[model samples]
Target: MSETESKKPGYAEIASHFRKLIADGTLAPGDEMPSMRDVCEEFNVAITTANRAFRTLKEEGLTVVRPGRKTLVADQPRVAATASARLKRIARTGKPYAPNERSVDHTAQLRSMADPMLAQLLNVELHDEIVLRTRTFVRDGKRTVFAVSCIHMRAIIDVPELLSPEPFGQFWQEVYTARTGKVVTKSPERRGARLALDHELEALGVDVPAGTPVPVLVLVNTFSDEDGPIEVWEDVYAPGLWQVDTE
Candidate 1:
């Protein structure tokens, strides 16, 4: 096979592609999927490969097999506005928020890195100054999410307004690129469930006794450009109060 053709994605990658489309609401519940034969033709793969990809989706509760050998997106596939959705929002509006959500900016300042893990993730020394931005999000009049963005100081040298407690009219990364000539090209993320820290508990208004271990969903993302990492975001979601487009 030609080099380009040889590098084509296999069944697993194809399954992931469909999973993303489902998670992002592109293929809504009950939407008919391409038949296995059509998938084979479209992806230039064998029918077995297409079947395997569909099987994977079915096993993952993302699809259902219909009587006519058709596949459909599963009803109520578990989803949340995860990293992919966040990246899309950042690209569009500089912040991740649905139109109905509201936010309260609690802190925005230049500060030293106190969290060792965060400092290490940012690849900065402990005492280095970083731009820290924190906010609480309210959806349907309920506090549901708390987010903190730690930005590299270098990116904010000329764009001081990044520290302002307000939303950018356009994508903030574009503003950064215009001001610093550094383009934001990559934003990789990791997520998991962890016990909420005391500050996080307070931010989400979870009233637990001291030292209570409240489970919370956490997502950490690093926004990078050609030079290196630009910012790291830690988002905390209250359990049972938030849903995300999981990636």
Candidate 2:
């Protein structure tokens, strides 16, 4: 049998399929999800595998399970949409943000890689030429995250828009795909915490207590296709603006 034919759908793959459906609005709020038996038959998976997929959705706050009622899509998703999910929304709609959400483009320019951590993450030499795109994300008129996107110089050559100071108003990966035909298939992410640097505090407009070190949540995502890395995005979330959604 071929490799593709030998593979079976796992819980993560099942959950991702449903996530895309919800992200694109195919599964609207209050829509009843298929029963576990239905899922099992559809994917030809065992009951345990199907149940695990549903459990993953529930843990992500994308679905609600009542005591005596069927599982339904949550009216308001507690967890933020994944990057790929947001891209799906942007593809359908013109913008990604909700009515009360917006982003301010701070700067986009070609610069030398200064941070050793970023260089290592991007798999580039120190002081290598890279494109820097910075933005501030706001929700309900409050600054929530300061974001920085580091792109290899190749992207700017392939898709010149990466050097534009003005926002593309869409994910650049889509633009890159359009220009170079290299589709992003995977995006690995990492999370950590660190004390806010002086520039980061200024950019986020955060004030730290005198003589006290203020910590910020850091989320880094690396976008890549089959070939390799496309871009690295680092988001510094303001304190009190980050929350874990367990519901």
Candidate 3:
């Protein structure tokens, strides 16, 4: 099977499909929503299954209840994010990651940890200092991405502010390159979506749309050279914020 055709689909994925259509203006305000049967047939799912998807849209206030008619798209819309756009928002640029708001970007801290696996994977000793640098991005009170990066602490002990959020990815790359003569060639990444846990929803200060799958974007990145892995990045994004096409 082609890469795209093999993905697993759940109720949340179904909800997100329609959510993107609505957010992207495919389904505009006052446009009649497709009948539940239409959703059922299109997705090849049962009625109860279809309802779960629709219920999410309703709870998120993305859809409106007409007095006696089918639900319509909400007058106020939330923008849908593309996959590539989502990953690079912080990595590429600084301002206005989300619509109508500039994200609150800040470096939280540099945490120290010791691990045998990370040492083995990165080819270091067990006592090697592995530092975890975390940065947060928030848009209009909602946490968009929690960026956690792992690298050997000695690589950055001299440049402490490398932990800060503002000029993270690029600045760190430059420093590491100059120091080691290992210019980063590529950052390979893998991504997928899944339902958010209750605590996750609570932490984001947003509740899951009822019966609707609350989708969260998971990204794993490994920055590498001709050698193996040098630096790694793990990032999470709120669902429906990422663009579908990411290369």
Candidate 4:
């Protein structure tokens, strides 16, 4: 172990230190964050710890990791409180509505078979029946959140037409309850990030010139009830679209 590695700070502490800097205006928007070496020296931590701390900050919408190994404060820093409030509203209404959104445009259809990747995610055999719901939450003609959901039907023997895109998840929920007689009690989600692919960049409407990769979030959610899992979905939220509650 090196000298600095002997007294490395915990991941939480590193994230907290930077968050304080940003909140107090010491680290203004567009300000470059400290280099990995700087963080290692300042916190007496290893480079890996520093990297994790940086990842945490990025997930919380506090920082942006740019090209050339640069990290800077994010423009239009999101308020976690605001995101949480909107999340509560979405939960109650079963709609993908957000603040400042006048309406939502949903388009969903049932597929005869779940693809291999989705089958693995749902942990069921491949070629099983499923419904793929694609929705774009728009406000004033600007897309806020573009999302997709995969509903597995290994358990459900019968279901009504889930063709309509309006009314959010109301009809889907009704069909779910009617078929399984189980109320969906939980739908937990996990957040992660990676470089955007060509198709993904187009879908998210991100514009990046050649040789540049846009960072994006990848979230996985599991919808379940008392007996077993009901639906599994993976949603991607563009930068400046969503935030992780830190407060």
Candidate 5:
């Protein structure tokens, strides 16, 4: 065979080279790969030829693309946390709220309270700060909804009476007006999609097979007064219970 014809296969050869690099730990996870030009120069090949090789690697889940950045090695088979398996149950059914706690039901409440865009629409004094409170609702051992609430710290501190858990029943706007002497404003938005994590499935009580995908709902909220933004809260729904409407 001619020297050119005798050379090893093209794309397969390139793929093998990269695979060795990965297997040998030379190209570790999160490591940025050389650019196409660099690979072409190193391999003494055309840019198109180098591109074909890289494409094969990407198709095999060996690398990922980061917009505005270089391609990098991906963590193969991605390791998941044990907590992920319990996130759905805890998020959807847990009682009492803790800071940074994850629960689907409570997250929904936070989502609802923060739905209104508050900061951009409200005008407020410089001394004011925003406060966010979130909780979850469960019925018969199943989580149903998530809720969130927010108000200005300065606006709510006056009524020590309102600080009690029962005060939450009073409308937030009324409480704001009573404290700040100004009306509160709200802006809300809703979105829905599939769950992207294992924890999401656990909280939603959905059975995700080894490879099954889950769906989710998202709510964005903003609270404000006549001056400017107060707080922003987001709630993500568990899988199987929400249908996201899209245009």
Candidate 6:
């Protein structure tokens, strides 16, 4: 029997099919997959069964669920594949390597603003002005290297106490639950490139020699609530220090 013929039809089977689509570029990154109803009809399964298949894809880092919208494939499949190739190459060499470990320290704060768009996203009552909570994360005493996050004030109204202190008073997971009563799933979009902003050089503590390029990795994350998207955040990293791997 053919290998394809031997496989059973179910969530695992569906996930594998989609995985191949992603790897072979049949479905490019940011490409939306067929709807749940469509997949169900095509596979001759119930809606619930199709949903489980999509959930499997999500857990595998292959897809993202937009509340009230279609599921879209993630673009980092290439990054994951590249990391795997590097690991295999290293294994073949049998070279000894030391492990480096670092601790990450995070902090958050609140900011007041008058931007109408920002206010609307936060679901805050606009008074011609609004307040936003900014979360800043600093690693290893480096002031320039940090994550500056802006969150809408309306979302955290019930938990005004979160605005206090360094750790931002609460973790994003907890905040997500408290505000929207839903779990926040993280799907990272990665891009390998060079730094563009002058401030980034200072923050990353890198001295760029003339014409030499520094590796920069950017992660854009969309935080979704039970109903849909609540917030989107961008994280920039120095490749020399931070590395991402997927199995």
Which one is best on TM-score? 1
lDDT of 1 by residue, 31-117 (tens): 899988788878888888888988988877778887865789876443336645756655544545553456775688989998787
Give a tens-digit lDDT track for model 2, residues 51-136.
99999898877799988999998776544443444555666665676434678857998889998988887878889989999988
Model 1 residue pairs with clashes: 79-244, 80-244, 80-245, 81-244, 81-245
Higher-TM-score candidate among 3 and 6?
A: 3
The segments of candidate 4 whose C-alpha lies over 4 angstroms from its true place after superposition are 1-87, 91-96, 102-105, 112-117, 139-141, 154-159, 167-171, 178-180, 197-199, 209-212, 240-242
Evaluated against the true structure, the overall lDDT of model 2 is 0.76
> Candidate 1: misplaced stretches above 4 Å?
1-9, 59-61, 64-71, 74-76, 81-85, 88-112, 123-129, 135-146, 184-193, 201-210, 215-219, 223-229, 237-247
Q: What global local distance difference test value does model 3 have?
A: 0.60
Reference-based TM-score of each model: 0.65, 0.64, 0.47, 0.53, 0.36, 0.40
Q: What C-alpha lDDT values do all the predictions have?
A: 0.75, 0.76, 0.60, 0.64, 0.51, 0.51
The reply for model 3, stretches above 4 Å from the true place, is 1-105, 108-128, 163-170, 178-180, 193-203, 207-215, 239-242
Give me the overall lDDT of model 4: 0.64
Report the lDDT tens digits of candidate 4 across residue range 1-247: 8865665679888887776556445677789999989998888777998999999999888899888768998865553223333344445455444333543445667675545655776666777667767765454355544566677655335554555556534446556677767787545456787676675566656778865867766666666667566676665566656554432
User: Residue 180 of candidate 5: its Cα lDDT?
Assistant: 70
Looking at model 6, which ten-residue stretch has the lowest summed lDDT?
94-103
Instruction: Go through the candidates in order and give the clash count of each.
Output: 5, 0, 6, 0, 38, 1
TM-score of 4: 0.53
Candidate 6 local lDDT, 1-247, one digit each (tens): 7775455378766766666555445677788999888887787667777888889778767688778878898654212323232233334333211111112444445555443543454444445333233322232243222343445455556556545544433254465586656775543443455553554554555677655666566544445556544554545554444432322
